[model samples]
Structure formats: structure tokens, C-alpha cells
Target: MPEPATEEGNRILSLWQGSWLAALIVGVLVWGLLIWAIVAYRRKEGDGMPEQTRYNVPLEILYTVAPLLMILALFYFTQRDQTILTKVDDSSSHSVNVVGWRWSWAFNYEEEGVYDVGTPGEPPVLWLPVDEKVTFELTSPDVIHSFWIPAFLMKMDVVPGRNNKFAVTPNTEGVFMGKCAELCGVDHSRMLFDVKVVTRAEFDAHIADLKERGQIGKLDSGRSEVAGVS
Candidate 1:
């Protein structure tokens, strides 16, 4: 089956294409003008001195200003996107806490509590609800690390002794492979994590069942497996 689309991925691709289009047009026009000038001033092998003149002020200004204008416009567009992307939405959004460890990842949902993620001997997997914006407050238990989901265009540094936050709204529902983008230790490449974005119903069911079994949330820790917290 095919993977779902992501807003971040789509935006990044569009930004790339748009930025190149402007630059490519400018580049082709500049080269075409240069070619026309050279051809218009072509000198026969034995022809008299080719007409030559020092740089014209207007021509010089046009040549320099064209590229400068393009750059300024691109900068403005990029800055606008960065601001829009980082701005927090006022609507209700779920929050998840992800922690970086020596060679694994841990996820803590405020409503569902925490759990040992991944396989018993393998790295942990991150689970999320598709189409939901998640505020991940990241920190490291030991060394510094970086979290990255390439398909989502989300990456952030996980620093020890301090918390760093990044947001993501994953529209796709699939397992996205993530890794520590920063080199923290000898086994940096071994630090891997999996993101599982699922449906809202599926997530709610999991949370409910987990809460009942006391598999999540510390408040229910002392309760019996099949009973509510007393």
C-alpha cells in the first residue's frame, strides 16, 4: 500500500520547487542576454576592432539588482513560512513527551501515562494519532541526541538538563523511521526509533484499555488490573 501525504513534506517540496523556479528563470534570462550580447557584437576573424564600451551604469545596476531582488523576495517567503510553521495554533491539540536515551526512545502521553516502548531488547516505537497535531517536549536522559522524521520534515535536538519542544501534525498513517540526527556516542547509528501514526479511534481504544489494565498513568499504578483506581 502507498503511504499517506504529510503537510510538512508537501510544504517542503513546494518551497523547494518555488525557490528554484525563480532562480532558474533568472539564470536562464541572464545567460540568454549574455549570449545575445556576444552574438550581436561578434567580430569577424579579420574585422576591425570590435565595438567595446565600459560598463554602462544602468546595465550594471540592472544586472546586480535583478539577482538581489530575487534573493530578497525568496528570503521574505522563507521567513514567512518559518514563522507560520512555528506559531502555535489556539485549537486543542494533544501533547506527547518523547525522551531520548542511550540507544532508545521513550514516549509519554499525559492522558495515557508512560510505558516501555519498542521491543523488550529493541529500540522503542513512537505511537501517535493520525491527523492530530502533537506538541513533543523533548529531553535526554543521558547524552544529547536529535529527533528526526524525514517524511514529516520534523527534526529537533534533544538536550540533557533542558527541554526542547517541536510540533508535528502527521496526516500520514504508517511507520516512519526516525533516528538521532546528532552524533552522541559510538553507537549513534544504532539509535533508531519508529513512529506509528494511527487513527484517532484506535488511539482512544488503546488508551482506554491501557487505563483499565493500569498499564498507563501513574495514578492508576496501585489499582488492580481490572478495577478503577481507589
Candidate 2:
């Protein structure tokens, strides 16, 4: 897995690692029991017929209960982490409206009143302030698209009429690649973008630059024309 860049991503990584460890432990125990049972119950040369037992109620209950207990444990942890990751509070300092279209992405920096869109030839670059929470509103104008940044360890579906939102605080400052995880259309492979996590000063400067270039107003299918190949 790619290195997580946000605190939330780190937590997600920890959960994934924990799940793998649990699975490995269960696998070892099961395999060990199977091997032992095969070797110990093997028929000897003089043995006429092994003890034919109809059923072992105790063993049956043990197997059933053990699996249920393991599932409940995993569910508890998964639910706890999922709640934390999907929680959306009003404490975010910045907000970006992410519009995923047919084969490109458009990022509307609502706080700055400017937007940047990408085309098939040129993918857009999304900027985020390091260590500051930014809430993203994901939507798609046409078919279903998925907004995925591997470094963030998160992905959300961008459905056509529904809006999905999530927030993340980028702790690291660097460039990361993002792409549409879903198969949208013919040019799905070209649906890619870049994420740049920078300092507050640099982030502000970028917004200012966008405003200076007259890229003002939110760019979405509902408000403005999306600048990209269909």
C-alpha cells in the first residue's frame, strides 16, 4: 500500500494491518488443528473400523460460537473505525467541491471562490493545506464515478444526483496521484488527477492565482460549464 499522508489514512492503515494479523492467527490455528486431526485419527493396519460417532454437539457448538465471536469482534472494530472516518463535523477550515465527470475532475475551492478543472489531455491538480482539515463534497454530473486517492486510503463514489462528503487533514506536504477507481466510460483510464499538499501560505497563494486568472465561481454541472472533454 502507498504511504498514508493523512492522520485518518494512518488510522485506516492500522485497521487493515490489524485485520490481516487476525486473519493469519485464525488461519494458523485452523490449519494446525486440521493437521493434528488427520495424523491422530489415521487408520492403523489392524484397525477394523474407526469409532463411528453420529455427532459431537460440544464440538459443533464450539465451532459455531467461535466463528460468531470472531465476526462480532471484527465488526466492532470495523464499525468504530468507519464511524470515525466518515464523521463530518463543521470544524473544517476549508471546503472543496469535487466534481467528477465523464473523464476528468473539477475542483471548486468554495472558500476561495475559484475552481480548477482538468481535461483528458491535462489532469487537474488539487491543492490542500497541510495539517488543516478540508471537507470535500463529491458529486458527478453524468455517470457514476469514484474519487480515489490511494495515499489518503479512502475512496467515495460520486453518484449522479447524490452528493457524498468527507473530510481529511493532510499531515504531509507533497504531491500524490489520484484517479477514478470506477470504470466510468471509454476514457476511464484518462480519468486521473494530482494532489498537492502544501503549506497554508502556498495554498492561499494558489487560490489567489486562480482568482487572478479569472477562474472565479464554482465550476459544476449545475452552476457553471465543466471544462473538460465530455
What is the per-residue lDDT of model 2 for residues 156-189, given as tens digits with 9 covering 90 to 100? 9999999899999999999999999999989999
lDDT of 1 by residue, 1-230 (tens): 12324665666666778988987897899899899989987876889876688779997998799879887999988998777656555442777777776666666786567443442247666778888777877877578889887777767888888877766688878888878899888778877878888999988876776667555643212112214523
* Local lDDT at 48 for model 1: 86
User: Alpha carbon lDDT of residue 106, candidate 2?
Assistant: 93
| lDDT accuracy of residue 227 in candidate 1 | 44
Steric clash count of candidate 2? 0
Give per-candidate clash totals: 0, 0
lDDT of each: 0.71, 0.91
Residue 97 Cα positional deviation in candidate 1, in Å, after optimal superposition: 1.7
